[model samples]
Every structure is written in structure tokens, then in C-alpha cells.
Target: MRSGGLMGTAALALLAAPAWAQSASSGDGDSFLGGEWQPVDPAELEQMRGGFEMPSGLNVSFGIERAVYVNGDLVANTVLNIPDIAAITPEQAAQVADFNRGRVVQIGEGNVVMPAQMAGALVVQNTLDNQTITTLTRIDVAVDSVATLQAINFSNLISDALAGSVSP
Candidate 1:
């Protein structure tokens, strides 16, 4: 009879486990990463462009995410999703980095640079008044090598800063 009671208690505890987990996982609605994402407006994109000039013959898009959360608390208010460069061959990507060597600039709390092969893409982030403005420019210039692209002043466009701010 004692063993039967113990078995019943164990089964009850097992049933309650999922409930506990569900409640814990639910968290506060505001604490979820998915809940923080909101659509970015076109004007916002223009503002983020700041003084940077876009190189001709390249495609650009902007996306914004609300602050990041960790353990149900706000960690980062904004995250700039890096542009996709999956279409570029690894060798070409390396050349892009080499072409922009020594052009990486750091201003305030942010950085601007053409990152290396694995890093991929050109990025510029500048923080003003506690907000971070990030821009990732993916240039699409068909050429045999980075040198050929450099001939057309491609490095100038890849070497500019983006503007925006994220509040805490």
C-alpha cells in the first residue's frame, strides 16, 4: 500500500513538471526576443543611411530588431542584421577585405570596416546619444577579381559610416 501511494505521488509530480516548465518558459511578454521585433519604416532606413553614399549597382535592405533579452531581461535594445553575402565566392570575399585594408575606421563606440573573408560584407556602426546606427552594404559588381572592382572606386562606397541610435 505504501509503495502504491509513493508511485501515485511520483506520477503526480511527473504530471506537474510540464506545467512548471511552461510557466517558466512563458516569461514576461516583454522579455521575449521574438516579441521585440517590429517592422522598420522606410524613413527610418533613410535616416540610418546618414551621410554614407551607396555605391551604384548594389542592392541594399534594412531590418531592425528590438532590444535583445537574456534571462527575461533586456540586454540590447537594437541589433543590426548583417547583410547576406552567400552569393560571393570565398576567394572574392577575401579580395574585398584586402582591397579595403587599412581603411577600417572606429568612431565613438562603433566601428566601420570591410571585414575579412569569413566575416563577409562591409559594415559601419556609429553610436550617437546612446543609440547605435549600423549599416551593412552588400555590393554586387561583377568582376574577375577585387582589383577589377577597385578600378571603379568600389572601395569608396564600401568605406563609409552609417547613422542611427538605439536607446536603452
Candidate 2:
């Protein structure tokens, strides 16, 4: 198909422009995305002196002097020490739960049922694998809908079956 038009030339020119060309190196120019620039008032400088502090200790502080959560004690004690499990998505968690619900038969044991603890460990392994995949795909958000939830659950099951974790 032959395509020649002024609109096409204009579109190409716009696409070729650098994303940051409109901004000044000092950031004084108007925002390319449309916004007004207002300088920080010099009078507010004195009030900013009490804004924040840099801790000399190794520990980081969230600056919540008073706990407002329902589990105030737990929240205060665990906030800093809490592990970042947010990296795992709700879909991955649901997949792990569903995989755990299925019956597991140990191979070479003549279809003997696996012990509960051993089954739990296998479920955990599958869950960890799911978390790794979801992390790779950057989908570490809550599963609010059924379709998305099912997709992640099925993905984990398929992956486990393909990897020989489950029998055909």
C-alpha cells in the first residue's frame, strides 16, 4: 500500500522528538504535559527546618509515633521487621491454596497417598514457583476479578504439570 500524507509526516516528526527536549536542564521551563511551576516561598524555609531527620542508627524509622491501626501493638513491633511479602500477588497465593487442595499421590509407592507434611512442602514449592513467575511478569497486585484469578491459577497448574511435578 502506498501511503503519503502531510499527517503522516507530522506524526513521524512528533514521534521523533526527544521526550525531554521541552524541559530546561534546570527544570525552570513549563511542563511539557501541561502544568504551572510555582517556586517554593522563601518564607516557608524557616518552617521546613523541622521537616525531617536523618537517623544515625542502622534502623529505618517510619515516623509513626503513635499507632493508629487496630493491631497497634503488632503493627508497631512488626512494621520495620516485616518481610516484603507484597512481592507475591493474590493470584499466586490463590494458586498455591488451590494446588494444596488437590490430592497428591507419591510415585513409586504404588499410588500411596503422600503424607500431609510432605504434601504441604510440595504445595509450598509450587507456590514459590508461582510467586517467582508472577514477579517476573510484574503482576504483583491483588486479584480482584474471577477471570484474572483463574488465569493465574491455571498458569501455575500448567507449569507444574509441564515440569513433571504432577502426573498426566
Candidate 3:
């Protein structure tokens, strides 16, 4: 389980990419290796983007048990094996609750105890039938800043520090 601080940081890094990218300077903006500094080619960024792809599917299996003996006891869990889904239709996904079809969403918490790393894929990818269209430009320079701010708030995250403290 993350202490919550780390989860916030991870979220910040994921959300603040464009903000940092815009402010970052390349090699002092003068010269590097006896040549003008050039930002990485967009083509390369596109190619590198491929590494992020995953075979589409849903593999779901887990076990949990909450038992209270007469003497007062509770909690049990287990490991389950779900065959590879890799790719499944909405009908299949519906079998698992909250597994929404169309458009990948953000974040997953491991077990009930571990919290999800607070990260949003700023890069929204659309995967189609055997083809994935990763939109490079769709990363709107503008987005509501809530998620970004919440990320960098390392000490106390929004959930904990959501409301400002007032002093008289």
C-alpha cells in the first residue's frame, strides 16, 4: 500500500507531461555536440509509442472470503486463475463489473488493500479491430488542471487535503 504521497506524485508526472515539455529547454538552446540542439523527431516519438501497446484482452480471476467465527474473526482471500482475455467483446467484458467497453480509462488498485498509483494516461489511445490509432495531437494543451495539481501535491493529496484549512 502506498502512503498516498507517492500515488499523487505518479499522477502529477503523468498529467504534467505537456506543461513540463513546453517549459523544458533543449541543450541550453545554443549548441550541443558541436551542433544545434534538436528535439527528438516526432516520427521517433511515434515509433517509440508502439512500445506502449499491449495485446488487448481481459483475464479476470480472484477470490475473497469474509468469515467471522463465533469467537469474532474476519477476512479471507484467495488467488484465482482466469484464462487470458487479451481481447473480448463488450458482452464478455460485461461479465466483469465496471469493465467498460470503448475508450481505455485510468488506474487500477491492486487488491483491496493496495491503492492505485495515481496516474492518467494523458496520451489517449484508441484501439480498434486489430488496429490501434494512438492520437498524438489529441493531447489537448488545455485540460482542467485538477488532476495535474492533485498529482504534485506530494505531502497531502486531494482526498486528504481536498479542502483548504482556515485559521482565525
True-vs-predicted CA distance for residue 90, candidate 3, Å: 24
Per-residue error (Å), model 2, residue 119: 34
Q: In model 3, which range of ten residues has the least summed lDDT?
A: 74-83
lDDT of 3: 0.35
Better model by TM-score: candidate 1 vs candidate 2: 1
- What digit string (tens of lDDT, one per residue) describes model 1 on residues 53-84? 13543344443333333334443343333234
Superior by lDDT: candidate 1 or candidate 2: 1
Q: After superposing candidate 3 on the true structure, give the runs of residues whose Cα lies further than 4 Å from its correct spot.
A: 14-19, 25-36, 50-168
Estimated TM-score per prediction? 0.18, 0.17, 0.25
Deviating ranges (above 4 Å) for candidate 1: 1-40, 49-55, 59-68, 77-168
Give the lowest summed-lDDT range of ten residues in model 2. 133-142
Leading candidate by lDDT: 1
Task: List the candidate numbers ranked by lDDT, top first.
Answer: 1, 3, 2
Q: Each candidate's lDDT (Cα)?
A: 0.41, 0.32, 0.35
lDDT digits (tens) for residues 1-168 of candidate 2: 123344345334444443444443236455544456455574453322212121321111121111212212212111111112335456545544644444332222234444565543321113122122111111111112334334544565577568785565
Counted clashes in each candidate structure = 5, 0, 5
